[model samples]
Target: MVEHQDVSAPARLRVGIDVGGTFTDAVAIDAATLQLVGQAKTPTSHDHPDGVAHGIVTALHQLLDQVGRSARDVVFLAHGTTQATNALLEGDVAPVGLIGIGTGASAVFTKRLAGLRTIEIAPGKHLPVEYAHLRDPHDAAAIGGVLDRFDAAGIRSVVVSEPFSVDVAEGEDLVADAARSRGFLVTAGHEISSLYGLSKRTRTAVLNAVILPRMFATADLVADSIARAGITAPLMVMRCDGGVMSLDEMRRRPLLTVLSGPAAGVAGALMQEKVTDGVFLETGGTSTDISVIRNGRVAVQYTEFGGSSTFLSALDVRAVGVGGGSMVRADLGARSVVGVGPRSAHIAGLPYACFASADDLTGARLSTVAPVPGDPSDYLVLDGPGGRFALTLTCAANALGLVGEQDYARADQEVAALALTPVAEALGLSVRDAAQRVLATGTEPVLDVVRALIKDYRLPEDQVVLVGGGGGAAAVTPFAGHVGELEWRIADHAEVISPIGVALALIREQVERVIPGATDEQILGVRREAEQAVIAQGADPHEVSVDVTVDPQSHTVRAVASGATELRTQDRSSRLSDDDLHRLAARSLRVPPEEAQVLASTAAHRVYGARRRRPWWRLGGGPEHPVRVLDLDGVVRFASPDARVEQGTVGDGTAMLPRAVADLTSYGDGGSRAPALRLLVGPRISDLSGVLDESSLIALARSELEGRDRREDLVAVLERRA
Candidate 1:
């Protein structure tokens, strides 16, 4: 419960709800401080006639009551759900009608689109889609026949796909209009992706189309409930790419919400911890989701659906089946621990042995049995005086003293050690050794994923950190980090991280176009489109920042815009002094205050540089000067191993762009390429790393400063490339 000093006035709050498979969690936070004020949990009402929406409302009401607040005080509202993902996993999706257009080679391409007809969503079940090919999509007569066939097949959602539609979408647009006119929810391939792959684009649209009806109904129900609860803010939904999109945007691109469950937890870690370059591990009762944030941005890539590739971009999260409630799998006959689980005590309706009193375990006998049918019968459970208690990974961590009292998963260490005595006797070892063996076995898989992510992303071993969140973080992440020899910390309010993430997430939208050799005007056009897209979704226009990327090899011009609908930075508490900013940066750098110096300054940011300490045993080149960019709000907005920061006005920065790029560009066998560049113009950290060509980079740099005053402060940050 939130203990407010005064509840007379309406407290400004942001409410977030995350609908998980087993529970729906809601949290309310001080929108300005970003502090957790209240939270509530309710069982996921899957069996209810109203479905998960009922659970959301129930949790929201509970949270409001707990905080002594009302829904009318909520300045922002957002939610993250697993409904779309579960639908695909369970084959509970609406049937879709696919209309393929074009002739000759494109006609053959249309036949390939029919492959979705047998898309197996599960072991024995497949997505139900009916495909129709039309040589001329604009032929109103032909479109009517397709609709009739679709209606006969009981399909209301339609997808229009034509070859090279990314280049020319007029035909696909016309067909989509015709379908919508007939009361069908329609999706066009080109709208989902700007890439030229016909098959991938159409497949992505089909994936989005399959879940349209269910998601629409659920979104509408939740929206109406929120409105009735007195929340006037535009409702947002968490996306799979670690951002929030308005409910309206989700209606158009519901596929983006498929795997957002893990993204929500990572987003919480990112915002709350001010994580720059690190991997976030969110450990749940049954599994852990691990993802990366490089250069202050979450790593994202095209995700696969039902074992097929799609153009949907999502956070690259990897899951490991080792968590707090994971049942221990042992080889009792061999007197050795084998592995941890994908099955958990929670699923088996058993309580953790550590949570029980020590007296309850008197004369307890260890028995190994499969928690679920067909699972290996090596899972250890203790039959005690209280009841049957599962010796889980959480028990192991507590027994080994790896879980502290301050941890969310904390339990009585002595009691945990006593509960594991049965296992110790079986192995002829001390209880701590048995527990150590179990934790090591459980964290092995998680360590593998961490190592693989580090290698794949080329993260600097010295700088990479591991931050953990979720209810079971203490059970897995700390020991995994110890084994992997990485720095780690648990997030505050880890159990409710998902809801906090939803509350703090910014409104985001991305737009892309395939234009061979896109000019300056074309690049800006895409940038403005992204900016407008988020504004349309209720992001404040003045607070919006669009980062544009013009890729020459792919000829893809991409823009990502992010903004806050209601500026949460309120009161005089947000801004800090220059000395405070430097102190914050030093703590973030893990260096002494004296060693951290202000390298440069802009209106809203201070660039602090510190000398990298090298190992005394090994001789190397001169010490590196790494830099961290700290905003007045005391958030580390960016960090790099080494960077060149030069502060000047917009005109000065524009004039110095070429020289800076030339000075920092690296030369190697691969050829010369400019260093990663970012300009701090006011509060916006304009990322120019995506512009590959030198001239184009300059043009983009100038474009970022286009509307700004020539004398406005600008800080150019060029990350030195070796």
Candidate 2:
């Protein structure tokens, strides 16, 4: 165990820990001065799963020594890692226990296994699946039985997903209690989400579960590393949802942390400039990340797992896999530099002889050699596609005697100097500036290649800020020059930026309640339960508030329960316990099986709730119980030929619509009755056709109101109205 001094600095110090595949990097900063106080890099050990933990300890100890401070002096620690990502990509997830309740509850579990994984506990099963279709007492009993079976399997957690829980979470809570009593963990659907779309929510749950184990592992490493460093400071991790939580809270929902790396860079960059709107680019050995920040926040694109196109959101970012060590190859006929990569050279060590042959460029370029000699495919090989293509084209041109030897030699040097230029241009950079950028950055052979393209294509030379990282930053720095007047900046820890970036997340959880379209009293009853649940998460019950907005036509009700904690930092003594935090998070994020039933009940109630009042037309005897409503050109014409169509008439030199349209203003007072659907056929000839399919009817009515002859403007009026 390494020990840190108890010395203190004048400014607050925030630490960033980056766990990479090859090394663990740590950067400590004095927040007030914005000065870096310490930096350490330690080799990663892959064979031992806890290698990152040990590396972190080593790095912290080294950093402490350099900064002359003890762990207790640091105010906050932020870290990032790839453990959760690796676990999901490798499919090492446990079999999840699913509980679904509703008419179609079973379908959710059945679908999980098709593209994902889930073990279902249906209404007939012994255990109460977190989700269930419990219509009555018997349904609850069946769920209890399923919980028993899950207990036998020692299943640690359960997910309850029901379609309409946004209205009623009590049913889910009841079922969850029964399962928990049987020793199973329960996650209720309403607690997990309020958004519609059962499939998307379920997928999100599975992804979270898949990443949980790795997240736990990473958290454990952080804890251990802290202990080893003689640090008593509380460790906190950031969430994708834009908040921070103690380490334990983060482990339960790992998906929230997967994108934390890029998010942190955004946060850091924003903080550095005190302005967030701009297109920021971070280039490294393995990939290039371009993110746009708008209105002091990074835009978010809810990208589907492994999908290409991104939906525009608050933040818009594009990542390309073109970087240093990208393969360069030549297609002699096209006379172009065809670079191919998103792949990279292994960061394990330095380059070897075999890599020499693989890089297609005639000049010597830097590369990493594989530790074990075998198939090149097994190694992260940089394709020489772009370099070779650029070289071939230039060589062919020189051979044809189109240029002098001095010029050819100069172009050859320029080709190597401009390696990344060709690829960057392909990504979005202009041809001429791209090559010039290569020339300005350095005289590397790759830069020369990029320069050749600039001269040939006349690309722009606008100055822009550039950030480079990974194993190849040193190689590309020379060629990625300052665009115009903008200066380029690199992340403090280049190779480990991804891991460090992950440290910028917080723990997040959300729950929704289904409010049935019931009487106002019943709706209020359901909302209270949701408010109670929200308060359990360290919120003051008094601070909780409910938002209600209803749509009577759709028989739908939207209610939001929200509360906020005081803006106080965590208490060192009561920092969250790992087990307890996970339990709370899992509970908050899992959808209950009773969701659909709740939604149905809420929907049903919404319709039934409005029965206290009758529509004006239905008030007396409801058309003598047998009147047929005829669909007259999209108008519901009643059989009573003597019925009067009510329309508000505005008598003026220039008649316009009455201040309020009839549908909107025809209601009776005291909420006693609904307004009648009335249309006033005017004296105009077009009015004889009655309500002309809403669109045309409005046109005719407006035309008559404006004193325009309906015969002359009917078609154009209808088209414009539509």
Model 1 agreement with the true structure over 1-722: per-residue lDDT tens digits: 94446657667898889999999999998887777888999999999987898999899999989988876788899999999999988888899998999888869878888888777887788878888889997699999988999988888899999998888889999999999998999999998998888888999999999999899888888888887778887799999988999888888889889999998988888877777778999998999999998867788988887788988889999998888899998898899998888789998889999999988898899999888889888899999899899989999999988876788899999999999899999998899889889999999988889899999998877668898899899998888888889988888999999999988888888898889978877887888899899999898876788787777788889899988887656446657878888788888777899999888888778899889855565344667678889877787788876678887888897578888888887788866667788989876788878776666677778777777789888889996555
Judge candidate 1 against the unseen true structure and give its global Cα lDDT, from 0 to 1: 0.86
lDDT of 2 at 585: 28
Please give, for residues 479-571, the per-residue lDDT of candidate 2 as tens digits.
Answer: 344322333444454554443443332222333333344454544444555455445543344444443333444443444344433221222
lDDT of 2 at 713: 17
The lDDT of each candidate is: 0.86, 0.42
Off by over 4 Å in 1: 1-9, 570-595, 610-624, 632-635, 665-672, 709-712, 720-722
Q: Could you tell me which residue pairs clash in candidate 1?
A: none
Every model's TM-score: 0.94, 0.52
Q: Global CA lDDT of candidate 2, please?
A: 0.42
The local lDDT score (0 to 100) that residue 643 gets in candidate 2 is 28
